[model samples]
Target: MLAQLRQQAILERVRRTGGVRVAELVRDLGVSDMTIRRDLEALADRGLVEKVHGGATIVGAGSTEEPGFTAKSARQQAEKEAIARHAARLVRPGSSVALSAGTTTWTFAHHLADVPELTVITNSLKVADVFHRAGRPDQTVVLVGGVRTPSDALVGPVAVAAIRSMNVDMLILGVHGMSVKAGFTTPNLLEAETDRELVGAAQRLVVLADHTKWGTIGISTIARLEQADVVVSDTGLSGEARAALSEHVGELVLADPGADEREAPAP
Candidate 1:
């Protein structure tokens, strides 16, 4: 594709999907990674898109504009995978855990599928399905009932009530955004309420977020930074954010995505 055509294609994808990843663009456009990065940079220079760590989000998306799960899954693919692997270490075998709805938590669920005698309670259909497909005879999954959101989160009074009656060793929570001012947040009001219930049900709160979530406030705040027992994110997070998290949260883990790639088995 020509420069103008390729950039226009990239811009359209971002506008339609709320974001577009550089890797996806490179593959689909049949171009080099550098070429796709240049296109994204050009688009960013025009204020057509906001450049994130691994992707570009649509310009002027508000706090209430929740992107769908598929859109979110495409951005920060490696970061989420790295965070998942690192966070999985927190889950002891034969323990109960709660996973809130988000792409990162969904990725984390896959890593936990084989843990013996594990019980998973979740408000995400996607997360539950991960365990269902695994069909681990020794594991149990409790999927809450509620209205489904664009991100596949089951929320409402039903989900909140179900979670309140349960207790888990850990809550692997994911947020739309996090900052000193907003703490952890989500675009959906019901999701925030349901997530708070999940937070209350757990003995420990381990937040899973990527670098791009910083400074991006959402419509509702889930919990304050001090409430988190641990926050697991990727190395792409900024130094200022790291300092803030370390001071407030019990432990701040920065997963190295490069290390994950290096450690992967050869195909």
Candidate 2:
């Protein structure tokens, strides 16, 4: 496999199991031991993992580590796409919307890029680019300006100030993690602040996340589960997760990545 793809696979394994031994990666990937070490080193340099004597562990076991956009976008590809499709159905044409930064929200942006007379306000450059590429004349995109995070989100005071003045029909949020206690969270403090601003600007909040995000906690809490008008995730979510989210969120929607444009039956 190419180095990028190989690294992504290794990263996924580590994230899934919380760590991976070099021997295991070499045996599973069919790469040299030295190659495995190099990949581990690369991931470590990006703060995505912590290199140890014989293996690597996911960075920020405390949930403060922030992965770059490229690394995050490679994961849960099918799940993100599925969640995006289901979330898109909630939007109506010509309505103003706010999209928070994250891979899932970026995927959701593509599904809405061509909606007629829609106005989009966002802190994610990636989401803005999706609309730009669609070249829809009737769409207006407002790219909030601020310092960019590892996740390609514009945050800090400038972004927050811009969002506070506007009101949207709905806000599509993508979070780093979600739990019954922590609700929705992100590792970056500034990004969390900006996201809170986005939340306040919208009449309704819809969060898009894959099942892997469950139980993962970030350093900062963006909002509680009850703040969400809807939470959309994949069928991969655990039954416990569905029950908790269903109780707190206004609605819990599950998408089936394996099915063609179908939502998983609600719990």
lDDT for each candidate structure:
0.91, 0.90
lDDT of 2 by residue, 1-267 (tens): 999999999989877766677877789899999999999999999999887657786666467888766557657778888899899999999999999998799999999975799999999999999999999999999999999887789999999889999999999999999999998999899999999999999999999989989999999999999999999999999999999999999999999998863446756
Q: Give the alpha carbon lDDT tens digit for every residue of 172-261 in model 1.
A: 999999998889999999999999999999999999999989898999999999999999999999999999999989999999989956
True lDDT of residue 111, candidate 1:
96
Which candidate should be chosen as best, given lDDT against the real structure?
1
- Poorest 10 consecutive residues by lDDT, candidate 1: 52-61
Model 2, poorest ten-residue lDDT window? 258-267
Error of 1 at 202 (Å): 0.6
TM-score of 1: 0.83
Best of the candidates, TM-score? 1
- In Å, residue 46's CA in model 2 sits off its true spot by 18
Q: Tell me the lDDT of model 2 at 65.
A: 82
- Quote the lDDT for 121 in model 2: 96
Indicate the residue-level lDDT of 67 in model 2.
Answer: 70
TM-score between model 2 and native? 0.78
lDDT accuracy of residue 196 in candidate 1: 95
> How high is each candidate's TM-score?
0.83, 0.78
